[model samples]
Target: MSAQHAAPAAQPLRPARAPTGSGAIGFVGPVLAVLTIALGLVLVRDALAVAGVISGDGWVVTVLDAMNGQTRTGWALAGGIVAALLGLWLIVVALRRRRRKALWLRKAAGVGIRPRDVARLARVAADDVDGVLDAKVTAGRRNVNVDVRTTGDPYTRDRVREVVTARLAALAKPPKVSVRARPSSSTSGGMT
Candidate 1:
């Protein structure tokens, strides 16, 4: 007698696409800083001009003098104070944002988790359950994937997979669990 087997199914391939430009608003902060600096300079110039510190030859000087002596100094001081405040505020905001970005980058790089740390986490996860003869685990991005080899009993294998997944998930992020079992010489339990 001859036996025929069907060919395996083909899987669809997913293509990678380039990232979108939606995050372009990140440039607005620097643009705003430049505008703030320019406005500050204009305010300082007008203030100095009204106080007779600069030559009153321009239209800005004429407008300042037209508002009366008292109003002119008030306007100049107000403008100077607003400009100074804006400039200082912008600098403080930029520095704070820079520090936050640096902190986020350091955390993403796993802070102080070296190769030895990973190996230790994997070893601890492997030694969790009964029939778990051997296990291997690796972490990526924010998730962990573990592979387990079990002795014989189906219940023990399932229990090991569940316990390891739970323990690793608690310590790390959510983990994906995969179990491969070798058939025993005698069938003591059924596979679920």
Candidate 2:
């Protein structure tokens, strides 16, 4: 009997759908945490000072008297407005939902490449071009943008474009690709 080998199954060329995310938590959670801690600390400090547990220079009493004065209406109104705005912002942040960062590549042999992975691939492809000092790729299902930084003395814009275009084309399904070249910034050479 002869040994037989099975060919691998074909992979689909579809981008992965973007993942849904509740991103407000990322912003609101941190802000709320900091504000809560700071405010709580202030309250505790005030209580301790008032109880003679800590020495104070009467700054709190001065602030309170000023706030309680009859002519402080304008300041009170401004403070109220600011507080309301902050509350509104906090609520909006708590309720907001956003898409997680990741592009879905059409199904691969087993797993589809993410936008991040595609970006890395694009950067690699760009870096392979001559004269490239650095490369950064922002990949999406609809487009791929590769920014190449070259040595100041040697420009490789065209070569970077051609190489990136070819590499993207070799993918299962290629999106529209654009390559931009510029002189390297202060940062040292690396792919992003």
Candidate 3:
């Protein structure tokens, strides 16, 4: 007896928004530098106190007060917890600084498409339609709106819609398409 074979199923494609190639977050360096400077200053201050160059009374008093009583206050605990959480968040963000690949990386990189680029491409696609005279296109994260000035042909708008929808559909995540059309004076002259 022979075994039966089955065809493979197709999966939906993810959107064309690819990851940006930039390394760790933009703010990570600045934030880390600030923290490092603050820590260094504290270290220096403590060293000077140990060496008797400066009196430790101020910090010592503060630490004593905190340990003795101030911590019991609701506001103090809340503030300390908030500060600790922020520090932890900063550290985590620094460690995994790589941003998600969904963003367009760079102009030279050419790995991903920007909204403006999408709009320009949509305009070109719309213009390619036979009766479309001019196409103004705007592309957003989830939408592409096209305003078409077309030859007086009654089907011009529908044709533009078809062409643009087909073109943008080539993208991984196709944005919602909206098309509006008006007859242009160019209709009397010919395709512009």
Candidate 4:
């Protein structure tokens, strides 16, 4: 008389897209938008003044009059050059690619690890190596650099590199690891 119940099927996971930095577009896009709006407003105001909808001459007329009243050819030329350079800079920024802000964790859905955390992890791994007295680590999108102060001979940079690399193996794309091992100041007779 008893009926068996079937278990519900597990849902499949979707892969996450890697994140990218905002690049130059982040600042330039909003700045250009604001500048466009300001220019449009100025033009509208000038049109309204021409139609007698406003009392005084608009900003464009005032600027043109000031420019004409002053013998400022040098100033005008400098301004033009600056504007041209800015336009070229904007074009370059628009074409440049955004740098990555975080690395993806292996086999984890929608999870990311920042470079600071990666460096901390690498430092921990390096500290675990035999004879390592202290470790400093810096991680970028594509590289991890480790500086290790050691108890003295017997500890090598290769050992630190190997340990750090192994610890970071869980990252989706583990950065290239580099290690520099130095003897402790007390043992090496120099300040580290």
Candidate 5:
């Protein structure tokens, strides 16, 4: 009887999109809202000045006068209304960002894990295996690498590899595991 092997499935090309850093939108959202509001203020100011309520100064001065000017009241009322609306929009954007950042901070506070945790877990697991005399594990942001000093026995090295792989899987994200069986004298050789 012939054994049949299944072909591997093709992987997706694009990485899945994860949520951006918390409060990222908060930083951007307010700036955008302010710009939009400024634009609205400009348009309204121009309209009012054309109608002869205020002098056709730049948008900023025109809008300012429209709000505070008493006698010359052409588009003053409309400009004030538009400015108020823009202010409200800016406030809303700021508030939304603050809320999102608060929520993200709360969540991150509870789920924090450090790279040291990865190294500790790997060392413990490798040391517990039968053939491994000692183990050193280093962890990076998203991965870990381990070095195992063995007692010159293939079985012990294999056991160390297996245990380390299993423990890392349980405690940390799956790390790339490499197993090296070194001569005892190599330990005296300065690690380069």
Candidate 6:
């Protein structure tokens, strides 16, 4: 007699996430690291001086003397304020989400699309309309603004919206499409 084995449970897949760029941490982290290293190096130098392995009063002694000798001044206050502001800025940057570099597409879980590429796709769709002479598209995460130059056909705007909407159907959360149609300058015999 053969023993029966039980099947393992299936785990649901996690939703796809768009890329959030490095943001301020990318710049601030290195600066902070360098400052820390410099401080460590200075402390080591000061230790060497204290041990009679180097010359001079050392930075720590000089700083301590200066702090003990001087009263709080406007410059010191200003520096403190500047440092506080820097800390606040760092907190804001660290806590806030980084800017998204691409948008998710419904075509596939691994697929992503950039705003510029979305604009290009919308422009191509707008241009496919019968009377459209030119198309310009500006795309964001939730909006696609289309400006079309057409052969003075009023219906061109509707056609552009329809075509662009259909083209962007594959997007997981498709942006709202706005189409503005204008008469083509070339067709209107305007200045070159």
TM-score of each prediction: 0.31, 0.50, 0.53, 0.79, 0.37, 0.79
- Give the number of the best model, judged by TM-score: 4
Steric clash count of candidate 6: 0
Scored against the true structure, residue 159 in model 4 reaches a CA lDDT of 86
Candidate 6: which stretches are off by over 4 Å?
Answer: 1-17, 186-192
Question: Could you give candidate 6's per-residue lDDT for residues 1-192 as a string of tens digits?
Answer: 334665667996776667778887888788778878999999999999998999887899998997996877999999999999988897787667788878788868857889999999999889888999988899998999999888887788888999999999999899999988788765565321
lDDT of 4 by residue, 1-192 (tens): 334666668988887667888998999988888989999998999999988998998889988887786775887899999999998998799779898788998878778888999999999999899889899998997999998898875546778888899999999899999887778766466433
Q: Would you list the clashing residue pairs of candidate 1? A: none
What lDDT tens digits, residue by residue, belong to model 3 across residues 69-120?
Answer: 4426788789999999988887777677464443243332335666777888
| Candidate 4 vs. true structure, TM-score | 0.79
Q: How close is candidate 2 to the true structure, as a TM-score?
A: 0.50
Instruction: Pick out the ten consecutive residues of candidate 2 with the lowest summed lDDT.
Output: 102-111
Clash count per candidate: 0, 7, 3, 0, 2, 0
State the lDDT of candidate 1 residue by residue for 111-139, as single tens digits.
23433344346557665777667666665
- lDDT values of the candidates? 0.55, 0.73, 0.73, 0.86, 0.63, 0.86
Which ranges in model 5 have alpha carbons more than 4 Å from their true place? 1-112, 185-192
Which window of 10 residues has the lowest lDDT sum in candidate 6? Answer: 183-192
Error of 3 at 14 (Å): 23
Model 5 error, position 135 (Å): 1.4
- Model 5 quality (TM-score): 0.37
TM-score-based ranking: 4, 6, 3, 2, 5, 1
Clashing pairs in 6: none
Tens-digit per-residue lDDT, 1-192, candidate 2: 334666668986664455656687777888899999988888888888888988983456768786675675678799999999989988887887675554434434434556678778879988888788888888886688887778753447767767777766645567788877677665653432
